[model samples]
Target: MNLNIFRKQNVKTYLGEDIKFSRTLSAFDLIAMGVGAVIGTGIFILPGTVAATTAGPGVSLSFLVAAMICALAGMCYAEFASAIPVAGSAYSYGNIIYGEFTGWLMGWALILEYMLAVATVAAGWSSYFASFIKPFGLSLPKAISGPFDPKNGVYFDLVAVVVVVLIALLLAQGMKSSIKINNFAVILKIAIILIFIFVGLQFIKPSNYKPFLPYHMSGVIKGATTVFFAFLGFDVVSSSAAEVKKPQKNMPLGIIGTLAVAVVLYMGVSIVLTGMVNYTDLNVANPVAFALQYVHQNWVAELLSLGAMVGMATMMLTMIYSSSRLIYAMARDGLLPHHFSKFDKKHNSPQISLFVVTVVIALGSAFFSVNQLTNLVSFGTLFAFTLVSFGILRLRKRTDISNTGFKVPGYPVVPIISGLFCIFMMCQLNKDVFIMAAIWLVIGAIIYLVYGYHHSQLENKNSKAEEA
Candidate 1:
């Protein structure tokens, strides 16, 4: 063991270069991406489930708790994103502040987060798409509409495969074009959400909220942990720092704005949902739509089904984009093959990386069941959040580096709270999640030792300097 894999990146040198990505995204585009990433199955589904199982009518408070925890991490992300303005998000921050091995580990964990997230969301999207089209007397063959399971008589999820590939192609068209689609999906989803809120409000029963803390405050805290996964996508926003204009200014706004918007929407839906239907009766896969159906608003429920598909689609788009950028950043650092970093000059997109990610996601969504592995995604996300939160403390102490952009307020307090909360949430995960995550980390370590360590550009540069 050389034990020399801990060489840190020079932040000044990394940021001083003209990274190949085209800075075409405005603040609005960044915020839209963040919103698109964060507001998927979470708002449409988790409220009712958490309310029923954990906090009853107090799920609204759960959203607030989760949002506060996310904000702590979100502020840390904003600081690093604005200051670094790079593609790898936490991975890059880890490299600059920690070292090569740590960076590689963070990147590997993010790969799990983004890749599995895209697959899981696509699987969920397939169900919604099927349900959305079912009432119209249109349906895919049973065998082709779900994952391959001989016992279940399901062959493959063609809808999931098709949608993943379509989003991948959209991303291959580059950020400018793909963002338009994301923006459209986000607007449609939010409009449908607003429709649900306003329409559902007319049916609110004051009595439904009487037993607000049926499970007590502990349940509310548990509900916060349960719904914490809903806030996962906002971090993907920071992964786009390289492609944003005035990243220093826009990055913080995008990150903080995403959490702000998502929390408000989440709370609104939770309040209306619990008020419209008794919390005990709200536990269903499609809670928002079901709430409407309970109130005899079938038409609006139908509209919400459409919204669910759109919402999940937007999430897949953002996840795929973020995953590709992460790969590009890792490859650029020579942790992987340099070929993966090549961009299409015309479109300014990492077409090769996009293709690879698309294939994996399509295969996972179409052929494999990811329900059990979804918790792994949550664990990976919290792990990244914890590392990013602590990475800021290391970054701020370096006199050689300076960031005039965003800084975490209240100094060490915010990041300390952020990191500690993330760890607390991580502990809340099932034991199996930790086992799987440990296995994943071990595999990453083997790869790093065999390939990443030897191929690293920084290692090579350091060796040359030593020889001189």
Candidate 2:
């Protein structure tokens, strides 16, 4: 059991293996993808709520804190991605640096991150979608339009499930196809965000920022912990290393570059938002639109709502795409049943994996509210970041590894700081979320012991089979 659990796969095997992922994404496409994932519901929906209840005008500072943390972990991820350049992101890094058991845990945690991201974002999408269609005389019933959260009185969120399934259907078309749609939606959403900032900036009341830290340090810290979900998707960009063109150069560019763009946008939007309206008054489901309503810009509010829905749609698409690839990668390595790795010959897509991921996300979104889903996603993501950061320390110990890709600047110091920061943020999460994550990990360990341990390809192979 010890031998099976600690079995490691060499870098040479991953590099030389025919991983079946297409290489069509350029550095720019990757940046766009990263931007697509980073700028989602957190910016559009949570800004108001977090501002009113937690940070007040200091939400901008909260954005700064979260960005700093993400940048550190993003750097570590860049190094691992550059060295490994595989589809599984942290799962791949963990397998090569820490061994099979750790890899399985990372993979399992990532499933939580991506799946909850989809659910929470879909629930967000439904809110904006409902608003976007309100003027058209379309009213969705409460029973089926919201999650089964007793706190919110919602029994099920039908629109959320529909959207996830729709995106999964789109994913089945192929990665190139799904990304093209995502790229377009991302460009549109960015434009809408810019419009909001520029227009809202003109009406800024300097007085609204009077007590910027109204809730003080604890509030800002709480805001940062909550809004960290905004930064969740940036690292998922690394999951596309296997599909990226010139990944050695593009992977790091995408990961770090996305964080930079997202941080600036998040800070700018929050500053402008709080300046336009008192942070207390901005805590609505559609805060951006609510702010616009204050200026009586109904047209702009409608467009922003529409843009938000489209933006969230792209986010759902990207997460589903990345998550399916992760599942496919794990399945291919025999850490899961081989059938899940099956690809459609016509589309060259992971049909079974996509189907499985879509079904799970749909069901989760139907039952869980945005807040519940976001908590789980945030904790799981922070935990994954911790391990990924720690893995960089282990990877650096190997002298046989190639020096072809991007390296994390500052080495051990950066990863050490990154890991510590991640663990600190993990501690900030709601205790209940931490408990749920623990339960999820235990389930993953059981699955690994029952199936993954015996089926691991590396376990059945000789160590001399691959060269460095």
TM-score of candidate 2 to 2 decimals? 0.92
Model 1 regions lying over 4 Å from their true place: 16-18, 460-468
For each candidate, what is the lDDT? 0.89, 0.84
Q: Report backbone clashes per prediction.
A: 0, 0
Across 172-262, the per-residue lDDT of candidate 2 in tens digits comes to 9888888888888888999998998989999999999989899998888888887876888888898888888888899999898899889
**What digit string (tens of lDDT, one per residue) describes model 1 on residues 1-468?**
557888987664455432678999988888889899889877878999999999999999999999999999999999998778888888888898899899889989999999999998899988888877777899998889888987888999999999999999888888999999889889999999999999989999999998999999999999998898898889999898988999989999999999899999999999999999999998887788788888899999888878888888888999999999998888878889989888788999888888888999999999988999999998888889999999888988988766899999999888999999999999988999999999999999999999988888875554554454
- Which candidate has the top score in lDDT? 1
What clash pairs does model 1 have?
none
| Model 2: residues with Cα > 4 Å off, grouped in runs | 1-3, 140-144, 147-156, 213-222, 367-370, 461-468
